[model samples]
Target chain A: MTPPRTPVLGRRSLLAAGAALPLLARPAIAQNSLKGTKLTILAGSWYVPENNTQLDQLAAEVSKDTGMEVRVERFAGDELGTKVASVIGTGRGADLGVGVEFDTYLYAPKLLDVTDLAEEIGKQYGGWFDVARAACMVDGRWKSLCIGQAPAAWNYRTDMFAAAGVDKFPDTFDELLVAAKKLHAKGTPIGMTLGHASGDARSTNYPVLWAFGGKEFEADGKTVAINSPETIAATEWYAECFKYMDPGVTAWLDPDNNQAFLAGKCSATINVNTIYLAARAAAPTDPVKKNIVENMNHGLWPKGPAGRYANYNINVWLPFAASPNPEGQKAFLRAWYSKNFLPNWTKTGQSYFIPTFAGFDAMDVWPDDPKLKIFRELNKLNRLAGYAGPPSPAAAEAVSKYVLVDMFAKACTGQMKPAEAVKWAERQYDQIAKKRRA
Target chain B: MSATTLPAAPARPRARRLASWLDNERTLGLLLVAPVVILLAALVAYPFFTAIRSALSDQTLADAGEFVGLDNFANLFQDDIYLRALRNTLVYTAASVVAKLVLGLALALLLNETFPFRRLVRAAVLLPWIVPTVLGTMAWLWMFNPNFSVLNWVLTNIFGLRGLPWLTDPALAMVSVITVNVWRGTPFLGITVLAALQSIPPDLYDASAIDGANKLQRFRYVTLPLVMPVLLTALVLSTIWTFSDFGVVYGLTQGGPMNATHVLATLAFRTGLTAGQIGEGAAISLTMLPLLLVLIVWQLRRIRRSAVA
Candidate 1:
């Protein structure tokens, strides 16, 4: 039979056999399967300029090191969740995602857990950075490694502080009130994105809870336990905290807060610190920008009885566990986590992007800068969920939707007494928890 | 001969004989329609039944949610935002339908008259309808920017009115969203009305004119009556569409400014995708189903009755 098929003895048959050999090994076939594979890195348009470029560089790095191809795609942050959901719902090409915080939490179950990859970051980056480490963990699993921290703290115009009167810094919440009043007397509004929009309130509101020693849950290092006594206080104080905000402050969200800060409409606002560098550059020539750039302070979150908690915000790059190469994904994490690689990456990102690894000297982010340097110094005291605890996404949503915020808004509007509002919020929060459990 | 008189044919047998008339044209028509009946049952009826069943079940994919009977529906009623969304959805639907009808009729009327560049103008009318919804919504958002907006720039810097937070301001956001939806939807209305307008006989309008009717009177009589059924169809379709619109609101307000602008579609999306409570979202969406069914059924009945009338 073999002799009858004499032509198969030629080099073409040998080549065919060689080609046919890999198809037989599922593992090898899976390996080769990813060679031409394209992974989408979805980013928001506001961040398109920086994020797309970084992702492109990452793809190049991955291609060079692992020879795996990748691509960077961008869309408006507003559209990312809906688009990703619709596509994924249709069983379409939703290969991977890099989303902002809300969408990340919203899509958690759908995402790949890159726990091992993040765990190995210690070997690469020489100990995961604490702030980054904390935020990236969920239920004690290192689902992601925080490549950067977007610590939300009260940024102020140091010039306004000087103009208002004496102030080194307000060390306590009470003192903050006095200082805030002085700024108001001097006619500078306090800024916050308390608007009911999804992103505006969630990212910026936690500090008020922390400052008031309130927490939805207890943090067992990384695990979040919802509903605690301190959380009630936090909710009550959150209402109080918004009292001094500028009129229509409830309408403000991240971009609105950014704009107010840019326009000098506010003496202080809490937000991610990424805008400092750009504000400085753009404000120099533009009067609006100048108001933001010169004489500003990226100070610590003002102290409450619980202590000043720079509410930590971090993002982790989680390669899917479903990746064809989990081991390869780990290798990629190792590359990302390398201590030597971080300075360049963080520097490229700029601002106080507290990198994941421990012992990273973040001073370089604001080395000589006056205001931003305060953030570098103060970032050490940053605590996760104000040290009371953090809420799982569902728990947080439960409390947020049913309780605290609505009462806080009422309290701020003077529609309800603060104490009455606090009690109402706590009761509502309890109901939300009970109902959700039910 | 009297005893031999044939007994009257049994009523049951006669009826059976009459019913066996499938060999007749009416039966042939029903036979011809049988494939469609089976097809519609397979495609539409089956899914419709399942969606209704799922709506009754409280189970969600996340919890591998266990069925809780009508518990989900009960919860849906308790939510204040859901109620607000329902109200907004109704308002939005009514507003959208009316706007589409009025704008569509106006455009159709304009296009009906002899005019220069008629073909170009007609093609241009379809531009908004043709552009993708997401893209069109985004373009509308750019125009609605609170600060640094071209619209605000014109209003504040040029016209000198104080700038309004078109999206961020709660008072204005809902109206702004409705405006954009109508802008995108009116073209479909116009195109349909124009098609309907073409179908109207020239003789009726000429007769109405000869009867001493003016443009408005002729439109009020001949034009209005002629196109009433088509307009009704368009209105019903647009109402259903606007009531469930997710993309425009998703792209524009995200049910924001304190969720004041949320409609049913956006609420469903936010709850399911953003909140990850798929069961709850499914529950919320099902609440809208009955309203849609009633509206559609009424329209169908009206369609049939009008045909007979």
Candidate 2:
């Protein structure tokens, strides 16, 4: 049976691979062999300043250790995706691209299989998450290495919740609704994007659907299962819940909520730690910044009808098949995954990059910070967009089209009724499934 | 004067060869235009034909798949979003074009008259045209922010008007996008119309006045008729530019509030670049080609007729 899209590579594959290739077997070629080779790695622009400095240091250290000159290039997330897509079939791009999602699946045929390297890393890091394995492994071969999974959670203002007579964050959907109404009455409102944002809409909305037991596809990952009573109920809930949100949330993009929360206009919002990190970047003595940091706190997504899940947009790094220096690229990947840099890198991420391996939990990155520790539990329950099924091309297509998020937005915005929105989404899911199967 | 012939003429070889070459007008003309012709074919024609080919195939960003033979176009007809995008493009272009023409003509008429600092005023009027489109669109994005919009502050505080959802509601989102397009595009029309206005002979206006015509009558008979040709050319070019506008709507709304503001260009970019459906994206964009061609042909014919008349 196919593995559920878990971040861990899975116990069965780990056990099978261990019997075949011993744990200590090093698949990496001689590092000194690529002394004169130069390769490039493409990544998204860093939201945190330390991330930028750390990457440069990492590249410099890699060059010093292996004598292979590694260069790093940065572009905005969407821009990087476009660049990768534009050069996919041309066999020319960065040797390795970081954080690419749907494009990784679309261009899987043009990526080098890193199954051996992945398994080796898994052995050292206490095994990969099943979702991470499902994301990178295509047709039973690993196409990319799961680098980081940014598990999204609810980041809210403590002061606002306290002022509304709520002492603790909500634990279920009903409680969240009640807290939101009280917070709205207190003048500050919650914000979960209900728009065509490039990232937030899909990342934040899918968990709400999952909370109500609405899966995009069945366990087989083949049948369309979105048109259900659960989805309709979720839609109706959004329609009412929207009344307590900022009126302008339907226009919010990825950065909009971050800006709103920082400006103190929002009581709560669903997002990763990027917003928290951005607030902390301000001068510590600054009253506004201090107030923001003191008032802000996070919670795991409220439990849904089925169970709890957070949207983990699992990011991966893949080596291009047409890379001129495969040995140099593989060496870079190994060095990047080393404990020497990985721990520091994870800390610099500031809870943004929750390590997929179990051993990473031992690192001080999450435990040291009071607020950051909560993220560990949140990331533990992270799931990919197609929660009940394996990550497939059809699932990726559904995400790219913003199918699930759009359904909720339509229902909440009065563009369509709950049932009608569900019907519309069903048709879209059918198309994606049919085209992918064909 | 007719048939007097000299008995003999001595011609140097180099001079005779030069004369022969200079006499070949057609060859020289072809040679002069060869560079431009080659450049156009390589840059414009090739990409256009490639778009057509891609539209007819199942090609994606990752792989160049087999030809699907009109399936992409057939699918677009059944796609609600594609139809909505097509409808948005037409509405956006038409609304923006008419507004630009009217406002541009008014500005041109005002600028044409001799006034204080006329030269400085003329230069300043081109500011919107001179500014980069992306930068201008970004500024507009901020101004249209739902919470802290300066426009909202002014409307509510100063003018006592209700707060407007500039980029949220479907009708208002379209209005916002079209308003920004007109703001940036009107300067192009103004400058072009101003040039045309200056070229009209002062004698024509005087002649109309002498024939017992008032200022309005003179403008209607002389200025309007004489400026018709240039105005039509500018209108056609502006229509093409506005129809393919990608950045303004993308920056301001991102075709959001449920894709209400998406035009063919944004839809195509989303489908091909973002969604990885290169073939379908190509089909959506190429649909604009035939419509634009027909518009250009019709407008050019009007310009030619006005010029001849």
Candidate 3:
């Protein structure tokens, strides 16, 4: 009679354990398959050291998740491009890494086709932005995964703007010019880098060029359209604005503007949130830095006659075709892009890296910081180096040669007239097109 | 006895042959020089030939391009940036070498005289040269910074004068880079010229004085002539180094202020490596060879002439 009363509690525990077996075995099988795999990732050292540390932590977590060993090596921003090119050429270094702007197009044939992974990421994260698609898709194939972009907004002094009778940041190019003149006359000029700076020079100049309806090439991507009236207008505007900016901006490298803004030598400059973040980090120990944190704010790029446009440096994740552990590389990227990881990574950047995923727009990354709100929608306004044209090798060459940047610089420095600068840029573009055709 | 001699005779013949070969002067010379020849082939010839081959092709970082001989060179002639770089290189080399020569000679002459702490002063003069080029360049960069320049602070605050745009202005950027180059390179010239000065017998100065030669007169006639060979060699070497100078300009200006300071080496790097146009970069580097070759040949002939005299 007692045997008839079965052990209900033991039976229930056994059934629950049986139900979880498949879920537990799935990971064990994956780990066994990738037990001996190793992946080496090369990333450019971020301006913020914390970003690099976060990447390292993520790599370690990924290594533990899948029984594959993962390593990340970082190099300076200037050297990263050369290192990536070397690895691609030799096919002996780095299984996966973050590549420079438009690298997908430059090294498309040598990259792994990650269309499936990219699509899955896009679907899971609402979708990829059009700019991301433009950057990573080459000839109808996804050559790389669009990671994020660093928006260089107008980092300015709020008190300085108010002191000059400007109650708010300029909303248009004309307003910006007036504000710049006022600020310069007050002895705190706005600085925009027009030197051969790899990042700031292009970020500022390209937006100005595109905002004025000037493009390096026509939509067809072959015909040179840089000598148009729109380009001439943009060059002329910059030349006039140059008179209001600090003359030292011509020599400003990537770091100069940040130094100038922090030193109070300039009232405003185009830069990433690093300036504001640096000020905040130092505020606790230094009274001057505290004052800077309270006074500084960031604004969207002023709208131009044609439209508002921004040229943030777009980065992508590149998996080399020659990677030995291809499966592990893809799996690591999957885990890295998962809901459990990417949101946390995005928050750590503090708007330094505005995620390209459309879904991330809903995520509360910059929760109590209103100063960083301007950068949230910056991805919507972004256009790559070759705006009207395809992001091809020729466009990349022109960009590397500083054709557009030089056009503005030549005019601003009074080395040439606006028309002459446009003409010179046109010739450079023509040469690039000819070479690409060859 | 015949059986034992037969076994040993073969070994003796081989040993005798080896010893005779070693005694041959021609064979010994060849054997001694073989290592150097192989080293040169591996280190110098291989890279040189690879650069030439790359220059001849339309290669890029991505693709191994087809042979497109002289096209990259032709493109350079048409490039305004290349033309500007050519002008900048000549200016940079000519200016740096001339400044280093004058300043270094003055330093060497001062060191030759017995002074308080002469050994200390002599060692101190080598500090710029001994410091790594990159580290020295970084210190100079801080000094030349637009906002935080100590030079500007002294000008505006201490001297009660307006601050100068040391690096922002195109002309001044060229001057700033040349200034750093001179600061770093003059010590090399000074140390070499000092060695050469020590080699000149002290009796020469006494002999010139006895002949009623004034100080300037003695320097022009005696010191100048004797120092000419070593000085010329130093000048030639300095010229080559300055012509191919990259670190100073790259570290300071990165050929900026509208490419005003872009020497050939920096421009080639930007065009070839940074732009991924490998062939064009190689072509830009090759442009330096011809000018350097002529300078070396002229210097070699002069050195030989001086030795014979």
**Strongest candidate by lDDT:** 3
Ordered from best to worst TM-score, the candidate numbers read 3, 2, 1
* Model 2 chain A lDDT-worst window of ten: A1-10
Give the per-residue lDDT digits (tens) of candidate 2, residues A244-300: 988788888778888888888998998888777767666365678668887888888
lDDT of 3 by residue, A67-123 (tens): 789999888767888788888877888899898666898788889999987887798
lDDT of 2 by residue, B1-309 (tens): 334433223356667987888789987888899999999999999999999999999888777878989988888887777788899999999999999999999999999999999999999989888899889998888888876788998999999998888877888889999999999999899999999999999898888888999988988889999888889889999999999999898888778777788899998988888777888889999999997999888987886776899
Question: Which of the predicted structures, 1 or 3, would earn the higher TM-score when compared with the native?
Answer: 3
Residue B69 lDDT in candidate 1 = 81
* lDDT at A278, model 1: 62
Clashing pairs in 3: none
C-alpha TM-score for every candidate:
0.77, 0.91, 0.93
DockQ, 0 to 1 scale, candidate 1: 0.20
Question: Over 4 Å off in model 2, which ranges?
Answer: A1-32, A64-67, A283-285, B1-29, B299-309
- 1 versus 2: better TM-score goes to: 2
Which predicted model would earn the best TM-score?
3
lDDT agreement of model 1 with the native: 0.62
lDDT of 3: 0.85
